[model samples]
Target: MTALDVPGIRQVGADAFTWLSAHRDAFALGEDALTEDGHVDATWKPLGELAQTCASVCAVTTPADPLHAPAAALLDFAWLQTGRGELFPRLQRLEPFATYPLEVYSVFASAGLRHPGYEAAAATTARTRGWRSVEQDPTRRLGVLKAERRSGIRRPERAAPLLRRTWLGGLPEPWTFERSSGYALTHVVFHLTDWGRAPAGLPAGLAAYLTHWLPSWLDTCLDAGLWDLGCELVVVAASLPEPPDPALLRDVWPRIARAQLPSGALEQQAPQDGADTEPDFLRCYHSTLMAAFAAARTVTRLPGADGPGRPPAHDGRHRHRGPGEHSEHRERRERSGPSGPRGEGVPG
Candidate 1:
């Protein structure tokens, strides 16, 4: 993949972060953000996503890397927006049975911006039967479980059964893929791999399955100008146990780079005549964030990458055993080494 233009990929992340930093205030939660009438999608969700993306950038890149400082700054900005991690507890109190607050706060927690009050309250909430029994789509369940793990409240026994229920966990027929399923599959991978920090967290069989099919899905997204989903697929490829085909990535990266506007923003699709008056910032923010995430993830995985931090410990609860894959074989792989959508489009 030396021919994959690693610098170009790095540029994509740099440019996207620059854009996000310029428009940082646009992510501020509104007055009703924590109120019962608040629209989580429009308010807390975007800010949380901003925090999560910034956290990913900081986690994967060292301080010396150009992308690191701005990302760190943005993460700090996002934490402040939550009142230095104070708002989460307030939101949790208002919706004690709800999980979004915990989900959102987990990003900050993972980045070391903990809120003792919120964590205490969340731990209590998590132990309740209501919290444990809340039904969610399988893909979403994986995300909640991940959030629990990140927040130090995870119930280890729950993860394996949840994994088995996900569509990707089953390794369903490849032809069943579609837009909705596409999003589901990408998220399943994200949660299982802890957003690419632990590639071994994904079963070897699933890695092979994605490696074989991601190219075609990526091409389709590129052809349709689906920047949001395309960036996600790029992340999936980069997250695999082995990097994807150099040729596939080499071809795909430029198309995504070109999709980025001069402002560093990327839209789900090209704007059409008289597109609704939704602010351009709102329309473009999520895709831009995804692009940065995809770029940062891909670059850090390249040979001789310089991040000082190693991947975090893989959550053994996340590992799946595919047909005929034995416990010993899985353990051997473990010894080898670690590896949105608001607004802009679908809810990721």
Candidate 2:
């Protein structure tokens, strides 16, 4: 595939997964064939394919800086998954309930959340808990009902990024882009969608609120990046409905070009042995998404588009919210909590 340098998008290497297939024999030695409780056979199917894709992205994308530890966290997630064995299955088992934002990010990017198999897997969990639907807001709903037991649920995972950004204020840009603002927004949306499991569509009432409020979320991701260090988030956020500043793009492209390796391969160029830095996190996320996209392409054969897909279609007219709608809703969002309502899955 051609090298990609979009503001919010990154590319990985094509051969990074070879180690998985090559190492399968060691895993087979366990008791009772691959079906044993701890033994891993099924994990091989997607893990190997995913590795090659992740390795490619890690090999290609720009590294993260100090501020975007969360971004780097995403990259590292990918690196850890490159090998095949029980670890892959174990991680998969732990993915859903992972409270760590990085685990969430990794799971969101690489897991089969969108595939029917995932939906099926989660069905039992949802039925058992009787939490078929989650309503964070009255008007909007998210069907997180399909539950699966995931380990390592920690609230601190999300708190860390929020606190870091709250304290640090913004992150530095690692790579430049032609459409920085729009690109940054796209990454934020993608990150949220992949990691946060944002619902597919917003409710009508919440849609109105989001149209007005999302720009701020985009801004937060961008400005926060200046403090936290994940230019990818900022770049994706910057690349939203509004365009980015031309001068900013002109200044950043050279850094992106230089970030690439000599062979134009950009998967995990940084040593895996290094301490988990922001760059490492970015590589992890980049690799994971690259792997997911590659898997999506291989399985579905659809050319992938960047970002969280598109917002629901609008007629292009902005209407004022009816007075009956809670004006307090606006005020609460203005106070800086979650602005938009959770969405249900994308409609057929």
The digit string of per-residue lDDT tens for model 1 on 1-348 reads 442454368788888988899999989988999789888888988999898887777777666677777877888788888888889888887999888998998988777777777888898888888987898888788888888878888574466777778777787775555666677888889888877887888988888878766676666666667788888888899889896666666777888887787778888665556243333877789889999988888877777676434323333111111102223323432332221111122755
For model 2, residues 115-157, the per-residue Cα lDDT tens digits are: 2333343443334334333332211111121112221221112
Q: Note the Cα lDDT for every prediction shown.
A: 0.76, 0.29
**Which segments of candidate 1 are over 4 A away from where they belong?**
1-7, 272-279, 308-345
Q: lDDT at 3 for candidate 1?
A: 23
Q: How close is every model to the real structure, measured as TM-score? A: 0.86, 0.31
Best by TM-score: 1
User: Which candidate achieves the best lDDT against the true structure?
Assistant: 1
**Candidate 1 displacement at residue 280 in angstroms:** 1.3
Worst 10 residues of 1 by lDDT: 316-325
- Candidate 2 regions exceeding 4 Å error are 1-118, 129-188, 191-231, 267-348
How close to the true structure is residue 179 of candidate 2, measured as C-alpha lDDT?
A: 29
